[model samples]
Target: MGEVRLYMFQTGTLKCKYHDIYLNQGEGRDWEIPVPFYVVDHPRGLIVIDGGTPVECATDPHGHWGATADFFVPVLDEKDGCVAQMQAAGLDTSRVTHVVLSHLHLDHVGAVGRFPGARHVVQRTEMDYARSPDWFQVGAYIQSDINRAGVDWFFLEDSWGDFYDLLGDGTITLIRSPGHTVGHQSILVKTAHQNVLLAVDAADTLDHWEEKALPGALHSAVDAVRSVRKLRAVQENTGALVVAGHDPEQWAAMKRAPAYY
Candidate 1:
């Protein structure tokens, strides 16, 4: 097996209402959370996980994020662009061969169009739902950000099993843990030493993982709960480090780009 190197970074912070993140608690309080993304180096190629916030969000949040920007505003600049971050870290952004999205949310799928010819992977369920999401979810999946006409798309299905070895090297694996969206998923990376699980929106914040608190917006609360529980069991069994999707506290303490897990 090839050695794997994982890099974690944040594009910026999103200002969202507390109630919107942690179920029914902190209804009126606004909070800022990190928009974290990961890049991994494997013998196969460079793979980017959840393409940080789109570069456009840095320039004009409203233009790219639409009305949703009113509620969940991104505080960013051009420096936070996926390419810029990689370049700064001495990584060749142009060498990125694949981009795996945890889900189709605008924030996670922002890099879909950035890497030309790079294979973009997402759950088949997510691709289908993105075609015509419930009226309430349209803003979360911005058409401008996801309308990548020329990029290669590799849609995955959960029918295959619980974990899909993305490269057949067992270095990067995808876990289908829907809840935040119809087909949301998380990533599990096995390095030489330990396992690291990026519990994307499935566990948006540590609060969700620790207390089983429901995230505010959901297609199905039942599914959300089940996904979190599944993630918990996976963590317990694998002894993997569970990184919350947008945890403010966790993001601050963790190392950013130029650092690897």
Candidate 2:
């Protein structure tokens, strides 16, 4: 079996209209969320899930996404930049062999260019949306780095049954849980100690998963709800540790860098 480690790369608070959607009521209170990226050190190589926001977001927040940017997300400094944090942990960016993206949102796919050698695994539907987005419906958040870097992109179309043995021992498996985006997915890592499920954006916080809540601003409200239920079912069946997309409590509990998992 292979060993796995999870690192919390970023932690920040965001104020978005969608927060109420998850709450199922319009609280009008700014939603304080935590943004984190996980690193899984399997037998194969170092694998990163969901690249956090780039450093540029903190510098030129308005320039990239304009006014709406601040409305949805507030960038955190320490955990925002992946390169800086990785270097501190003594891990060279070049060592990353694979990158699993939950979706192509600006907050998630910001630092994709850092690891040029790494193969990017994403859902084909998400890639299509990033290429040609319906601005009126969903916000445009695709970064130019994705196109600039000649990345080896692996697009999953139908299901995630193919990546059953990521760790070569049935430990780490990528679960395709579509909801937030048409191609949104989650990671199921079964470690020696426990089985952990990284529900990246599939459920923003534990509140969403526990209460079956749907964020207000989503591509499809019904689909989002369905995804949450699917994740819950997995949690029930496997008894895995369910980590939400953005939960401040979970992020705070995790060890940063040098100290992994």
Candidate 3:
């Protein structure tokens, strides 16, 4: 195994409603947040966690996202797509071997087409939800893109907990953590210095984890709370650096152009 380093690809940022009660007391406020996609350096190749919004959707007036678009809008120019961000970091998108998605939310899976050659990994339950969604309950942002890409797919059928070695080298693991969605998960990158847990939408912001707050709207509020507690235990047990799904503070603290370890 080689030393693992993390790079934040700021495809864009958006002004979203602050969902943490401590921050807003049940009231919503506009806040700037990073639509961050992460890249991990592994011994075998680079891996990207959650592709941010695609550049084309930015101007699609009748896009599927609807009003939520205004909340998690992409502020980056078309030229600043994930591919461009990867190039800026001295890494090519084509070199990425795998792309792991936490869920199929439009904001999370928007750039699925960017890495056509890479295998796309998603939970089996999430795929089922995407294929036959209760349109009234869920949003379908990547359904068309997923159908068009014809990308290779790897589905996780069994429960994933403890640890998972993606490359069979004990370097990269996807720690199963459900609740925000049926198959929501967090990525654990074991680096030489310390382990990093990319807690996707399991916790949308740092406050969600720090305050143990749940997402305002969830399929299951109780389950969401349980997931948050589970993640907290994982963070405490491993002593890993935890990164939230869309924390504005994380984006502000990160170096935009070059990659950071």
Best by TM-score: 1
RMSD of 3: 2.6
Candidates ranked by lDDT, best first? 1, 3, 2
lDDT of 3: 0.71
Residue-level lDDT of model 1, residues 158-183, one tens digit each, is: 67877888988777889998878888
- On the 0 to 100 scale, the lDDT of residue 240 in model 1 is 94
- Model 2 residue 23 CA deviation (Å) reads 5.5
The lDDT, on a scale of 0 to 1, for candidate 1 is 0.86
Q: Tens-digit lDDT track for model 3 on 156-239?
A: 875554456788866677766676776777887777777777888788878778764666535566666777788888778889
Instruction: Pick the lDDT winner.
Output: 1
| Every candidate's lDDT | 0.86, 0.70, 0.71
Q: lDDT (0-100) at residue 223 of candidate 2?
A: 80
Which residue pairs overlap in candidate 3's backbone?
A: none
User: Which segments of model 1 are wrong by more than 4 Å?
Assistant: none
- Across residues 1-261, which tens digit of lDDT does each residue of candidate 2 receive? 456666556634455654433645656666566667777776567788776775666667677567657576656665457777777777767778988888887778755767868888887878887777787534545456457558888887765452444546666677766767777878887755677888888787777777646655477767877887877788898998888887777767866667765
Backbone clashes, candidate 1: 0
TM-score of each: 0.96, 0.87, 0.87
